[model samples]
Target chain A: MELSNIEKLLEKYFEGETTISEEEKLKVYFTGEDVSPDLEKYKPLFEYFSQESTVAPTRNITLKKNRKSWYYSIGIAASIALAVGLFFTKTAPEPNHDLGTYDDPEIALEETKKILNMVSQYMNEGKEGLVYLKEFENTKNKFIK
Target chain B: MKEGAFITLTNTFKDKLFRLAKRLLVSNEEAEDATQEILLKLWRNKSKMGEYKNVEAFAMTMTKNYCYDKLKAKETGNLKIVHSNYQDDKPSLQRQLEAKDSLDWVGKIMNSLPEQQRAIIQLRDIEQYTNPEIADMLGLNETTVRVALSRGRKKIREELLKKHNYGVV
Candidate 1:
């Protein structure tokens, strides 16, 4: 191909007007050993594109493996965290007593007074029953005499 | 999509994703990291991936977005820069090996370009994507894509020429 034609193609290329096949043509032309001197400067650009198409660093397989392992590590860490949270939440005991109310002196005093009142009531009832039992015993003795 | 379908999509596009990231980030380590993160995100949103007409395009778009976010995060000090030390000087390397030097230069130039231009060059030049496809990926009008690509190419050519006296030489 004429150098001028090649230059025109290059112009089109820079204008983003070349088709894939034309681009490939430019690559093959620039990559040839006998590239024209006038085209030498643009040589690097075409050569760069051609090389980049095939010469990119291969996907680092080791990196991929490391990533797989890293993911596994993250998965394990997340699982452990979730398990610990579940264990703590599931096993922790519920507080049944309302200690907050008893923390007030007046409430505690009222509770104490209620307990004392119940005790007095039971004691009075017991004393009355004893008195009735004593009366019954005296009446029975008089009848026997 | 089903899990298996999504896995298939990921498996299918992983290399492309890596390539795109590598092109964008200019570091293999960063590219790998970006690819993994992108894949994980795709996997997480695999169910919604099916909503797109083209899964590969969707994957590419997602990869680009993720790379942009990573770039921003790196700028904000939320991410660390991981360098790759792989040299092209291996003895057994082919004549195509010299091509890598050119690519390195291209990568540097692309990195120096504005974000939109760099993306246009990546999709149109490096990835060989059609203008329409690039438009879809970038959500720009096809004419806009064409204009951006032209401008990007002209800029790169200008740089290459200024550096090496491209055609005048």
Candidate 2:
């Protein structure tokens, strides 16, 4: 790469007319130590661009970290949410469980019959006392006659 | 795209993405954040990635837009240079200092550049994307891309020449 060629390329570069290869030639010439003094003013500009290119992110973005199975992650997250929802819904108290109501119709019917039978037996005892009172009233009526 | 293929596609250019972000946003932390976001955004849209002919250029375009939005939102900040790879073992201390000064100066000059020009120079010169690729990434025709790039390069050169004449070295 002659200095004349580089000079022409440099002019072309500032004009935005240089080919990519021609721009590469300018970067190559200027980054090396042996630039002619006349082009020294432009050295820093080219060197700045090249040097800037060498700058990688100081902290790695850790593509590896992000590359983990995102699908598996999404699946785990969804399952956990569903599990939490299910647990809350299941553990919440319901109104009917505390009541002593029977679930089976046959058992409910039998229990109802037994309760009514006990009530009728108490009623029959009271009615027998009333019969004694009726006999006492008949004897009183005979004495009055 | 498959996960494996998507990862490979993005892994190749994450640094370039970061560099472009840093170039436009002028902050390492912000640039890193922007890179992460853009990559994640790419991942979220990976289903649609197959629709494009060049995913790399698409990603670059996204970063350029993201940074422009950020710049519009944050209208003020100083230029901060982060050259992690430039070594400290220069044989002569003065030469190294001079290089650093020049870099700092260039960084400031670049900071004042219009966002479009900054993006153009970053894509074309540093990333070495073809002019057509750059034009496509920026949503501009080839002529506008060329005009902005040369204008940017000329501005930097003009500033460098000014510093030289002023005995700033």
Candidate 3:
């Protein structure tokens, strides 16, 4: 292509109107050893783009392994935690509160008697107070008559 | 797509995905991670592959999205562009050094561009994608893509011109 054509292409290129082929031509011209001083400045820009496009990652990636590693570890940890939870839940002993009770039948009877005696003593004190009330009622009845 | 067909399709575009990721993330390891993740996602959803008219474009879109998300998630402040360190086959050692230096300058200029503009230039110039295709991948109108591309190229060109005239590094 003529230098005139290259110049026109560069103008269009800067305007973002050049077709892909025209851009290709520009790249080829710039990449050539004999680039004119007029357009030589643009060579590095295209060369940079060309070089960048060819960049394949140096490291090889295993899509399956790398993608799954973290999730897989979490999944396994979660399942283990759940399993341990279920196992502990199933095996946990039932709570028992029977430690404070008397084991001997005689001792149990003696404690019940003590509680009943205390209850009767309080009841008798109330009964004694009622006798005074009976006498007061009798006197009032006589007055009314 | 069938499994076999899906594998073939992925193989064809995996390099493109890696390159796009590398361009955006500016790190090979992160780019490789991004590519692997995207490919795995595509493989997992191979059943829905038929829905997309342009799978390559769709994959490229996924790569762009994933790389952006990665950048957002990263906490590091000083992310630098990783040059593929591509050395041209110039004959003279001095010429080779000069070429490397120029390429490095261009890389820095590209790194300084806004993310969207940088992506537009990468897709349009390096990937040789058509404007419409880039628009599709970027979720922008074709005219918007063109304007951004123009702006990006003009900025780099102006800088290069300045350097050429002033002989400044």
User: Which regions of candidate 2 are displaced past 4 Å?
Assistant: A62-145, B76-100
Better of 2 and 3 by DockQ: 3
- lDDT of each prediction vs. the true structure? 0.76, 0.85, 0.85
- Give TM-scores for every candidate, taking all chains together and pairing residue i with residue i: 0.63, 0.66, 0.74
Q: Which ranges in model 1 have alpha carbons more than 4 Å from their true place?
A: A55-145, B1-12, B78-103, B166-169
Error of 1 at A23 (Å): 2.1
The candidate maximizing DockQ is 3
Q: Which candidate order results from sorting by DockQ in descending order?
A: 3, 2, 1
Candidate 3 lDDT at B10 equals: 83
The candidate 1 chain B region of ten consecutive residues with least summed lDDT is B90-99
Residue A135 in candidate 2 has what lDDT? 87
The candidate maximizing TM-score is 3
Candidate 1: residue B63 Cα off by (Å): 0.5
Ranked candidates (TM-score, high to low): 3, 2, 1
True contacts kept of 1: 0.53
Q: Candidate 1 vs. truth: CA RMSD?
A: 19.6
